[model samples]
Target chain A: MHGLVNRAIQSFVTDTYGPDRWRRVTEAAELGDFEFEAMLIYDDAVTEALLAAFCADLGRSRGEVLEDLGTYLVSHPSVEALRRLLRFGGDSYVDFLHSLDDLNDRARLAVPDLHLPALDLREEGAGRYTLACGPGMPGFGWVMMGILRAMADDYGALVLLEHHGPHADEGADDEADEVIAVTLIESAFAAGRAFDLGARAG
Target chain B: MIAEDTLAGILARLCPMHLLVDDSGVIRRVGPTLQKLRPETPMPGQRFLDLFDLTRPRKVGCFADLLTGEGKLGVAFRDAPHTALKGQIVPLPGGAVIDLSFGISLIDAVRDYALTSADFAATSLAIELLYLVEAKSAVMGEYGQLSRRLQTARISAEEQAFTDTLTGLKNRRAMDHVLTRKAASGMPYSVMHIDLDFFKQVNDSLGHAAGDHVLQQVARILVEETRQEDTVARVGGDEFVIVFDNLTDRPRLRRIAERLIDRLQQPMLFQGRPCAISASIGIAPSVEQPLVSPAGLLRLADLALYDAKHAGRSTLRFATPRPAEPAWTRPAAGKDGETAPPSAVSGRDS
Candidate 1:
């Protein structure tokens, strides 16, 4: 994983929790100093240990933690540049969903060594989409679901997201290949209006 | 459905600022955010390269050059002199879109652009790294201070241990160390063993406080008469030893001892009462026998001192080599019942 990915997790913990909490998590992980550089490469075991420690400290499952990280990446102002990059994909909610398939290519332009899991999007009905993620990342499908929900809020589209276990059909061999189904209940652009009105009232 | 203008407004809000440039590097469109960042409104026909200078991606020369480049580049706008912006330039069909975000120092960016922590990406770890460096520096500074204090205390303790409390001269222990060192060097040297003529009389008549005053004054006289390289130490009550190094000439050594005796004979006030005291000095020259140990040298000097005391006091004597006789043997009395000089007594004993 790129340093950017680890940094995002660190920021997710610090911003949502506090620096003290992050310190305790690192201590529980038996990591010393926990110094990280933006462009430096680190062992994959370090990230795994930190995540495991975080899961234990927070008493949450790994999937839930990753989902929270995904939500934080979009909502936090610290990741405003990344949110802008993701928003540049398209104008509408469905356009953004389709652009997910080429996200890794776009990300590679910024970081040459970045290797994100491949995503496949297919339109099933008028307002429904089927998304499949590659097996390269485990338990990351939940993070993708969180990102989709946040993107839906950004686009002012009401969506119903569901996760069916990897083998929805008899032909599926491994759990690494899983598909998520998304249904759009309303595209009224009402959420953005409410947010803007709240901002104005404040 | 969202209108095109509304979507563009949303995009502009997400970006720091953006500029649309033609193939000729002329500004074609300016986002509303860009208008707010600049002091003057940008004209559509103006050249984009003339308005902003590229700072990062050092290889990129102009706006046209950035169209062929990858990754983000830093830019400094002439209109906003103090602020630096960073982002990417994406090539379009006939032109390029330059998207800029503030890229100055974090402290300055926060203050100047009114940006909050939310404006920064969580991927940036430079802030936390700087904090750790500062914390480590503070700890090192504290440790350095403590080390310096400990060194000062050790030096003070060593000085106190080797100094005489009353006379402010080197004590017996310090003299022992110096004599041992000099003896090991096998250099020609001389030792003067001095005893006050009537130190006990001053203490019995005027009390020990006046005795202490006289002793301090005597120490000052001895230090003043001797050369800087000599070592003056208080070895016992009313007894002092001076070690003069690297001197072998007898006439010069005798002159120094005579001057010390003359100075001690001068009258000095002790508690507002005139008091007079003299010193009996014994010289032990090491020119002929430089290999003598410190203890052997002290015993020879003491024998010479006994000779000086028997010669009716307030006089000086030099130790002569006596191969067959021990230093502790006392000189014999004169035929008339008075103690004879060292040479006369040695002759009588032989």
Candidate 2:
């Protein structure tokens, strides 16, 4: 796993659950006193160990923790720069949803080595869309659900989101894709949070 | 087969900045967008030629000349803040119809007039262009951030490559580059070669860690005895080289070398155990024999270092001028003591 991904998880845990909790988790995972360096690469097993530790300590499933991590990434003040980059997708919630297909490509422009999950959004009918999250680590669909729910609120749109975990249908084990179905109830249900094209000087 | 009134309505919807004039060159009507540009200015009922000055079709002076104008027309308001527009003109039975758009000034016009996508014709690509501009800005902002991060990483990597991790001094590679540059510069300088006297014994008696602590202390002492313009490098485990820029005075060089030897002779404590060490120095002042290559200079200093070691450890020596042959072919120490002081190495250039 990229150290940036691990660092993000570390920051999410440390900021939301307190530094003492984070220290206990790292100790439980046997990570020693070293912190993840953003520019370095680490073993994928390190991330698995961290997730397992979080689940064991908090008594919560890995999916629930990852979903909350997704929400914190978009809504946390420390990661406001990420929110600004995402807001450039478009003016409306519908436009932002359509831009997901290009999100991986756009992210690669900044960090060429980062591997974000590939997304395919298919419009089934008016206001109804099915998003296919490519096979990767488990629970990424739940993360996308959390991000979509938060973004819908950011755009003041009422939306119904459902995450369908990896499943095999008709005795074929190849259907490993995690999917999320979105039903946009109202594009402009209320006045959205104000956004500016340029960052204002403090 | 379209009625005149319906044609007027269609023109209004298609080109909101269109203008129509009668046969006498009187303004019959102005498009809704053009009127919004300056709401205080009454445009209709005025002479069409008086309201706008045709910038394109250079010699156009009246409506008749404009009809003969072959290419695209360019016009601007005749009043303050003369907003320019580019369009085409079509001649009717009595007058002419002129349809204008903001051209390249669309962004500024949108900001100045508070115009929206609804104000433009449905077929226009203005909305798409606006989206592209927004996307370009966002990508450029992220690109700038990436550039800054890469620049910082490059500088830190370069620093690490040229620095000795143990002593925190310039390593052999960095010293080689500096020596080459200084030798090529035609300025007289001095090269001082230093070797710790008891560094090996310290490592054997105490440990490698204690030897490291002693070397780091020796590095600090050497740096303190040299000027900021001089470079002190750790060329080997117990060997260092100092290039004194433009200093050839033997008396001052001897004093600095003595001070370095005195400092290195001090005992350093590591893990509460005292470890003692000393240094031997050899100086090759270029003013004695000028224009030597960097490698040749180091050879001369090495010869002097050999002589100092023979004279007993923790001492200093100066390299005597070489024969006209070259410093590279000069004989090493222990060959003969014929060049000892008061006999042969006593000649001063000035």
Number of backbone collisions per candidate? 4, 0
RMSD of 1: 20.7
Over A1-202, each residue of candidate 1 has an lDDT whose tens digit, in order, gives 5566777788889889999888998998899657444454667778878888998899987767877788788778776555555664555677779889988776665555767778899999989898987765565677788888887888788999887655312323444666789998887656541221101110
- Which residues of candidate 2, in runs, are more than 4 Å off? A1-144, A165-178, A195-202, B3-59, B63-110, B113-128, B163-350
Q: Candidate 2, residues B55-153: lDDT per residue as tens digits?
A: 887686567877766647888889866778898888887887888888877766776677655576767666545544554554466467657878998
**What is the alpha-carbon lDDT for the whole of candidate 2?**
0.77
Taking the tens digit of each residue's C-alpha lDDT, what string does model 2 give over A1-202? 7766787788889889988888899899998665776656789889878878877899987667888888887788776656656765667888889878877776665566767778999999989999988765566677788788878878899999887856321213324778899999999998877655334211
Against the reference, the lDDT scores of all candidates come to 0.71, 0.77
| Span of ten consecutive residues with least summed lDDT in model 1 chain A | A193-202
lDDT of 1 by residue, B1-350 (tens): 65544645654555536776787789776665455555365546888767777677777555677777684778776665556778788877777777776543534544454433233333343333322333344334435665776699788886768778899888888999998898788877888899988878888988898889989999998899888988999988899999988876778878988988898888778868977788888888776445556667776787788778768678998877655324343344543544443454454221
Residue B24 CA displacement from its true place in model 1, Å: 24
TM-score of chain A of each: 0.87, 0.91
The residue-level lDDT of candidate 1 at A138 comes to 62
Clashing pairs in 1: A77-B118, A78-B118, A78-B120, A78-B121
Docking class of 1: incorrect
